[model samples]
Target chain A: MQQVIQANLKDNDNIEPVFSHFETQLNGERSSAWHQKRKAALEELKSLTYPTTKNEEWKYTNIAKVLANDYAFNAPSDLTKEEISKFSLSELEAHKLVFVNGIFREEFSDYSSEKGLHILSLKAAYQAHADLIEAHFSEIASTKEEPFTALSTAFAFNGVFILAEKSAVASKPIFILNITDTSDYPVIAQPRNLVIARENSEVTVIEDFVSVGGKPAFLNYVSEFKVEQSAKVDHYKLQNKGDNNFYIGTTQVHQSDKSNYNNTVATLGGGLIRNNLNILLDGEYCEAFMNGLYMLKDKDHVDNHTMVDHLKPNSYSNEMYKGIMDGHSTGVFNGKIYVRQYAQKTNAFQENKNILLSENATVDTKPQLEIWADDVKCSHGATTGALDEEPLFYLRSRGIGEDKARALLMNAFAEDVISRIKSETFKSHIETLISNRLENR
Target chain B: MLEIKNLHASVEDKKILNGISLKVNAGEVHAIMGPNGSGKSTLASVLAGKEDFEVEEGEALYNGQDLLDMSPEDRAREGIFLAFQYPVEIPGVSNTNFLKTAINEIRKYKGEEPLDAVAFLKKMKEKMKLVNIDQSLMSRSLNEGFSGGEKKRNEIFHMAMLEPKLAILDETDSGLDIDALRIVANGVNALKSPDNATIVVTHYQRLLDYIVPDFVHVLYKGRIVKSGTKELALELEDKGYDWIKKEVEEGVI
Candidate 1:
């Protein structure tokens, strides 16, 4: 493991420049309290090493090719209006914040909301709301345990920050679009986000990572969320980077007393993608739901690692992740539920299911539960299988051809997961995308 | 029309259908009553081209075509339908969608244009009435959470929608109550036409009371031991299979 880490560091062309750029930005006068925290975080990041397959959490996902690539780091590039328009979501009246190459693009953002909500770029938020930013930035994400979280903090330049004050309800969702256009050379971009929802607040956030041009690029992002007592928040992360892009993202969330947090991560396009989602249920009566749907084709690879920690008593968490792998693609799902000693009466359930279309397609799923409390109700299960032949025959016998029947069954398998999306338009859009993928096959 | 000559099938080298022979013309409903382990379901599965059962020596003819040579989907396209003894539950596929795909697939086989959404719904509504299936059930997943009687009714509903030339009901009455049995039988009886035939495979005589068969055959072990009219079903129900076993032992079957 140490040899792999040393080799990755020796071939590190993508991340050094970004670290230097962040250092250059910090040379100016620093008034925010988070500045000191950022300095400490960067020092902590420099001492840690990147993770490898030898690590238990990353056993099934290999990041050797990703660390070997030489990528440009956080270079400023002008984006046209046409390119930014491509990131618009259909049928959503949202406050859009666009980031180009991980730097906040103010000219293309709209932050006008009638509700008492603040959605600002991270740089601007750090300057404007230093106290709130200092209190929660990188609070939930542990730099010691995760190498990617440490790296993200070491080069935190610009990202989106959302704040919902006490008793405030943000009727419209806030959309964060991270666009990468690296046509000149391979580049790396680190986008770090922070979300804080105070007591009795309700909000929904959508974070989209997109690679605009068909260029070889890498995106490493970390998002930290803090949900206060009795608050409700729904978060969605959509990673549809270009086929030549590699992405490693970490989402860390902390839930308080009687709070509810729901998150959905969708990975549709990427050469090699790894997503780590961590939720800490720090208070009693807190409920968290983490759901994910990944569809891969060609030679793409997608890996999802999720952990839900039940720290207090009487908390509940449910997670379901489904993957459909076709062509020569591969997918991995590792979900763990942990019930601490004090977390009595914790009800946690996790299920992972995958469907392989081709004989060469592969999936590795491990659903685990570690319960210290005897009274906790916890269960986890994982299954990997081909399409059911009986259902295929039932459809074919109806006079549907074999191809169409297979497509229908495949679509139904994906639709079961897609229907869990709360937004109807989002659900339908995903349904259309899944249908197209199945039909094309 | 369908014909099976010297039909012998086995699974894992264990012979199930040993030289079984049967024939049925269109516009006739033939009932195959048998004791347990009589290879009744095996015959149905073999006719539908299930891959597990190996046909050691047999020829299944459907409309003068070699049925065994066709794939299951091809056999289905050739107007061969089998209402499964236990309809497989597909958790996320709607019944209406499944039926529409089947209908269009058969249409494609016949070189016909696919039905538009409006026309398909119109036809589905008509068939739903014939089978006494609720409209709500059509929108749910196929046979998911359905009761035994509902599954049988769904089979009849599918048979009505597909309108195959030959239909095989493999123990459709196994788990149904008296009222459900009557409803399912009535649905099948209503779908009878001169262009299509029905094969009702069952172990009991109660189902025949509703939809009386033109011919009844008793299968013992791997082959049919007796063939007669509706009176034969009554006699078998009265005397039971012990009499048939005794007759076979005495060389009087």
Candidate 2:
């Protein structure tokens, strides 16, 4: 395990080729504002260095090994719906947008028609609704400090773009299905997504990341959500990729007055995965709920970093994340709650709990709350330990085997976050995934 | 149905039960009364095969099978149930789901088909009446935020569901009120049949009033110093355990 310290993606030979491929996919939008944003993002990415363990933010998660591979940029796949039938949620009736190797495939995508609701690929939206794209694109997901966010912005030609117009309620959810086919060569897919829920509007988005091939694949995803005044948005990210894939994603949310935003990300499997979820409570009386569940085994590693910033008065936010690790896996949770001086009467709560089933499995959790407002209330806690011996024996004394008892306990640990899911279909789907993973491990 | 010969056990290398022998037959109820730290609960735990307790030298034969050699789950699947003194709270695991998993696993062990949802619900409905447990409590997290009386009642409900051949009630009346004790004792009495047996291990003789025992044994320093009929329980209750302790100390029992 050598720490090569791959400080800058700018020095890698793969960057130029990947940028050139991204430019070719732009389809002659060189004069557009989006192209200029990409150019500016590339320049910003060169100045930013890849994070190392020495950096406090990445102290526990060392991603140098995942980034050491030489990924191919020219990855092209023509996978059909039948090939990816295994990953489909049959009960989920929503608008389906499919992407392969970060390239939108219109033939495999279908959308539901609804008045005042606009859904398109980022590239298509730049062409049809350039004004909207120009206004929201790159506004919240800044690339100045984060190299991965910069990389995603530099190659943001293909992804999902959704806009819910004023007072428009989406009839159903919008499912963005991203699949990676690395059977040909090791590849990388950087997809940028933007979601806007206008004033008094509501929308739900499900991002399902899956991979088909065994070769090494990397998915760098960045999504921005703008929840306007009195609007509601529910976001779910299901990361169930192959064993040979790596994932790093950033979800940045901006909230307005009286808005509500709820997010749940379940990372069941992957070689290495990292998630950065940040929500800004910039308006008064906003509400945010963040829930996450990650179960890892067999050398899998996952790191989740979440931040909630309350800048206005009378806002509330609550976050709870739980993890189950076994078989030499690693899990990290870093949550920060910041209440500004003016954010009086704010209430924020954060908790992270983990269960390590094996001696080799490990977890590092840190919950930090910084409050400048004297009238605000904030609390944070983290706990990491083995399953309770009393409960384990209680289940076994009633005829459950040792393995089944452990699995039941693990499932019970995950239900805290799973119960927060509002969609029954999605909740059952997640429960199945979590239980299957727990049993197999 | 259950036989124990010179049972000796210890936890963490500290001796608890030392050289004790007892036998319980089908259709019989045996009550063991003892003072605090007199190895009453240790005997029940050892018979139930709690892993923390190591059997130093003993043989527990349940239906002529070596119960001490079997795992706790196997012992349970083989119709041996121990009602714990303190049931642990398992958050997020509903009482119904926990019972279902336990029942199905026991059924699979006995080469029987697992119960379906409809059958399970019906059985649960019937068993709830045995202990007067509410339907809402079954759907909530197991034993979480439950009152002392409610937890005890739920234990009886679980016992009714499992229907074990040998039921070991360990301090089942410790935290129960008078009404709760009556309901729980009635549940146990209703579940008793000619094909099964019961071992009531208690510190106080009050529980025996409702679910009367056929035989009473006084355990002093891990060995039965006295054995008699139901009248022995009344004597111990009226006279207290100091006389029994004095007899054991003076070798006059």
Candidate 3:
């Protein structure tokens, strides 16, 4: 249990390797010790096979489009700080880590270091706190089964590393802005991150993926979170990329006894987006929640896969994801809950619901529960259908037009999850983004 | 004012309203009484342009315009309001916000500007008195967690705000206690004006004691077989409607 789990790589014939552009990286670390670790991650990546629709977990998502086009590597570009101002949430005063083209830009980044609050980029943190980063960096999130995670690990240089010490929280939330702006050719950016929350500490992280130009940018990202005993963490990932961008992300969390983990993934804009999230209840009396909402239009595609493993007894997990699909878009959700043999008295619930707005739009969701313990309670359900016409008719009968009626009904449907958010500032921010997206469609 | 001629309709290819014809003028209250499955509510639904019902052959004129040709929202905007028998509960939508949106949409249809927030709240406060509605109830989601009586009262409150020229109360008196019945009837009476009309559909004569009707018609099967004044309600209550069924069975209309 103290060592990292190992995974061997085998090549599959269906997936064509389009990652030759990532043969080298621009990591600023000159330390010889860290260079050897990066080299080994890339060597492991070469032996692994990429997943395709033929795989059971990737059946609904076809990666032909991603493999068809050629993507360039991270190219050095001259973009002023004002250029990325459009993607910054300036309204919220907090720590900012700006990564442009997968390299940390110090001029556009700023942070306030409160008590026990340590926030810096992975590159800078490795330079200053090498021992702390080496001890915890790849210790939990392994590059074994997921080749994409291995690839990101090989080239990760400009992501965020956050730590909230015992009972210490930053004055505000931390914003990690990963902007991909490569105007010449299609490029790729890998931003790897790690978060550590000490005992009884609480912090929130907002990680955003955005693009500015017409280049077909590909984002291969990985993030690891370690929540110690009695600590709380709220993590949000907002994926709003360009129409030609592709995003593949993996997030791993290790929770201790009496710790709490809340994770939400909101995919507002992306051509092809996939999220793989894994949470492990490493101690008893722990709780974890996973809630996601994806709003897709214009032939886009989004897929979410989550797994929660209970390693100890008396733990709880609740997972729910909803999708609103319009145009010819597609969505996929697969949730799995694993209760170990000795994890008795475990409570786990999972639900996935999708509303298809058009006949051509589609969704495939599977919520599964695997329990080895006899005294545990677990339930899973999945539903995908078009919007109910009765509510549409009722609203129209009250003098609201058909378009506005549809928008209001969708908003109400989203409210079931949006209401769970505690911050009015954050809730209204997402509400306005979603409303504007629906109205323009 | 409204007029119907040979109105026939069906739901899911099953005939419901067969050849119903009636006339209602301004300043008049007409009550249509019938037993269960007698098509009284069907007639009201057809008048309100519910799309679930397919009009086989019918013509309805509201102010000399073809009422059957309008959409449900357009019909509502053109001064034709039908209080639903079972109101729909919409979660996450506040009652006050729904009312405001409805009022503004209806006003926009008539080429009028929307009311400001202050003006809108002022008007809402005045009409809320008609039902004696609590201010707290206005902030909650529409009809969510509401009692049956509260839902019925909210319907009447909506009627008071819309002020339609032709208001159809379909089964509004059902599932109400005597107190709630009196309050709802009083709300209707307070909203009445010389330029508007109402058509009440019910199964019992108990509600008639509160909302007095100028004319009462007996609907058997799908057609109106008999017509009389308010005194007819007493007769129907006295005879228990069996006599009318027997008369209709013998073709003695």
Fnat of model 3, as a fraction: 0.53
Candidates 2 and 3, the one with greater lDDT: 2
Q: What share of the true interface contacts does candidate 1 keep?
A: 0.62
What candidate 1 gets wrong by more than 4 Å, as runs, is: A1-18, A26-31, A76-79, A212-214, B249-253
Give the best candidate by DockQ: 2
B106-211 per-residue lDDT for model 3 (tens digits): 9998999998999988888998988988788899988889888898899888888777888899889899999999999999988888999999999999888988
Off by over 4 Å in 3: A1-36
| C-alpha lDDT of residue B173 in model 1 | 94
Task: Please tell me how candidate 3 rates in CAPRI terms.
Answer: medium
In angstroms, the error of model 1 at A184 is 1.3
| TM-score (C-alpha) between model 3 and the true structure | 0.93
Which scores better on TM-score, 1 or 3?
1
Instruction: Identify the candidate with maximal TM-score.
Output: 2
Q: Which lDDT values do the candidates have, in the order given?
A: 0.83, 0.88, 0.83
TM-score of each: 0.94, 0.95, 0.93
Task: Please identify model 2 stretches exceeding 4 Å from their true place.
Answer: A1-21, A24-28, B251-253
Interface RMSD of each: 1.5, 0.8, 1.3
Candidate 1 residues A204-238, lDDT tens each? 88888878666677788898999999999988877
